[model samples]
Target: MNRTVVRTEDLWKVYPQEPKPVEAVRGVSLEIQAGEFVAMAGPSGSGKTTVLNLLGGLTRPTRGRIWIGEDEITALSDRELARLRLESIGFVFQAFNLLPVLTALENAEFTLLLRGVPAEERHRRVRELFALIGLDGLEDRKPGKLSGGQQQRVAVARAVIGEPALVLADEPTANLDTATGAALLEVMERLNHENGVTFLFSTHDPRVMERAHRLIHLVDGSVESDVAQGVRGGVGHDR
Candidate 1:
């Protein structure tokens, strides 16, 4: 049986604006099972990013509850939440977010270093992942030296090196060209298939929605529709 990796109930995130409060996410609720490749799609300002932030504990909801596995993250203390995020949640942003000063290898293994994993082990894991994702020879390059696709691939390596239970990616492929984006998606799909790493993405790209096994559409801060479909080539069929 597939385990429920994420669950939200009556989720709401309201920003206090001058004229009135803006509801970024209102009464949004959903469940994502482990190992599922899911995408949340909507127009700009449709609250997809807000929902991902709430699920990742980057922001507290104005109302409602969120759970990662059995723990209710909304109830966790700030410090506790930080720890949980570090250990169980991975994030990829539209901006590659790679530190310009660090080499690709250093950037990829930074999370492991934070968790105090020994140097040798961190290198071992990152090198293996880099090879798997077609990043073998670019390890010594910094973000400035790599192409957009390479930088994004390094960012992906960083996100998954620790093998987090869930990865929340917001517009991960927005900055890449069509071919580059497709390649990145393939890398993510491989991770989801081989390592059981669950991915929840907030994307506006149709290509992304097409690759996802489950797609949730949001509008005006609410879930307009949620559907399950087969991925291209049946790579992520329901299991």
Candidate 2:
């Protein structure tokens, strides 16, 4: 079976600052299981994004270990880590980083194309995702032609099109209005339940945290609290 869980042990990350060393992530450890919809919740500068970066293989931790299933990722080479990201992990960014020149379908199919998925198979998969993401007829529309919500949904399609073991999304709804962000969150939750994909997202939005099955709060570079299902206020801002 593919590794569907992620684990971290005594993780730490520090950046070189001009004045003094700035610690980004402190002694934080946790496990996220398959199909879990988790939110890394906190205010700004709480290290949520830093932790997401470490987990997504976009950056390495300065100390400790990270495991995605059976593989320990902290020791991997840059090339190897890049390969791991392409193979096992998917990422959604706040800015909806779609290629401006590409159509929506093209953007969603980009990763599969890089991994050498055949054209017919890739199109079929992307078409299905487009339908699921409520972008069926807009498949050929460019990012600039779409609204913020639509663009973000396209980004979501791109992230999960290849069916990665883990999907890391950072501030996915930050650019959308309240109704649009809630709608996007619903789409993600539906995907999590239907596709059995594990999703870990960093957000300051209480609406995002409220929909999460689990919440991990970060403060001062450390995990301030880890709350499981049904604990809404454990790590969220007030409405």
Candidate 3:
């Protein structure tokens, strides 16, 4: 059975400065179980990215604790946190962030390479991931050659190629058209259902919230509401 993948206790993020600090996340607490798809929705500069950074181990909280399973990530060294992120978390950013020189397969293969997976296994995994994300025919295409949706598909393939327990997506559909964005989200939803991977995304789009199984709304750096799928009125389906 899948386990609870994330737990945040009174999480707080404050950007330090000479005078008053900017508080981004203020005493927020959350728990995400395996196979759950949760969305963090808020206006711009409302601590959504800060929350994502904290969850992905990219930024340590100024106060409180973040635990990925039993690991207290906020207490780890930078190197340790980096290693843990590499091994346990997959990230999808607003920008595709694919290397312009690498093909889709090569981009996906990069994640496996970082994990010390052998070339043969990496190749196998990359091909399988590409096929899973509907990027099979475009494996050899560079980011410049692929459409925005196709490139985002490659990014998703790269992010989940290793099947990490947690996937953090920050405004994943920000760059795509309506139809393409919906398709990309469907791919993510399918992945969560079929693979039991937990997804914690920071998004402000109605489309993103529409598909989420839960929406945690943030305002002024604190959680204003936590609504489950189907409990609130929305435009999308959650299964």
Candidate 4:
């Protein structure tokens, strides 16, 4: 079997509300292997976001166990959880959360800076990544000056800069045009395939579901199906 990088057993998340408790996620059990590109497909309020948040260590589960590698996330202190997130998880949000005052290159290098990578090395790696994403000449531009697609590319670069083992993309392409979004997915796919970066995406995008090697269909806070898409180990679904 492939090495399991993330595992969740009987996971549950409940939020207190005025009328009643909101059960956001219900008894989710999943194991994500190293380098696998998995997609979680569901409509709004279907627990997709909850699953992503749990996986990213954004919030502790109300019940059950979450493991990253062999470490149990639910057992860790908050500081330890934060450290784990810094070292092992890379997040790409739909908002493209680039620092407004930073240039594209600076945004991409932010994570590396936090990691204490020397400035010269960070610049070198940023150049290579910018070229990889076809944003070579736009490195000096800030997020506001770049197109939505460009900003998203910068976000991807930032996420990958740390070389985190797992990347959690939450509606990563929701803001882009069709062509741009497809290109962005291709870039992410290449990283997952060639660099062995595992990806777990929370998406309603048919394109994402189609391209993903594994489809995890969620409905009403429960898993409806967890199927291998195409041939065993191949991308099987498309819009």
Candidate 1 pairs with clashing backbones: none
Off by over 4 Å in 1: 231-239
User: What TM-score does each of the candidates earn?
Assistant: 0.95, 0.93, 0.92, 0.94
Best by lDDT: 1
Model 3 bad stretches (over 4 Å): 230-239
Which residue segments of model 2 deviate by more than 4 Å?
Answer: 1-4, 230-239
RMSD of each: 3.0, 3.5, 3.7, 2.7
Counted clashes in each candidate structure: 0, 0, 0, 3
lDDT of 1: 0.91
Query: Model 2, 16-129: lDDT tens per residue?
Result: 999999999999988787778899888899899999999987888999899987779998899888888888889999999999999999999988998999989999998888
Cα lDDT for residue 121, candidate 4: 98
Overall lDDT per candidate, in order of appearance: 0.91, 0.87, 0.85, 0.88
Best-to-worst ranking by lDDT: 1, 4, 2, 3
Say which candidate scores most in TM-score: 1
RMSD of 1: 3.0
In the predicted model 3, the residue pairs found to clash are none
Q: For model 1, how does the per-residue alpha-carbon lDDT over 12-52 read when each residue is reduced to its tens digit?
A: 99999989999999998788888889998999999999998
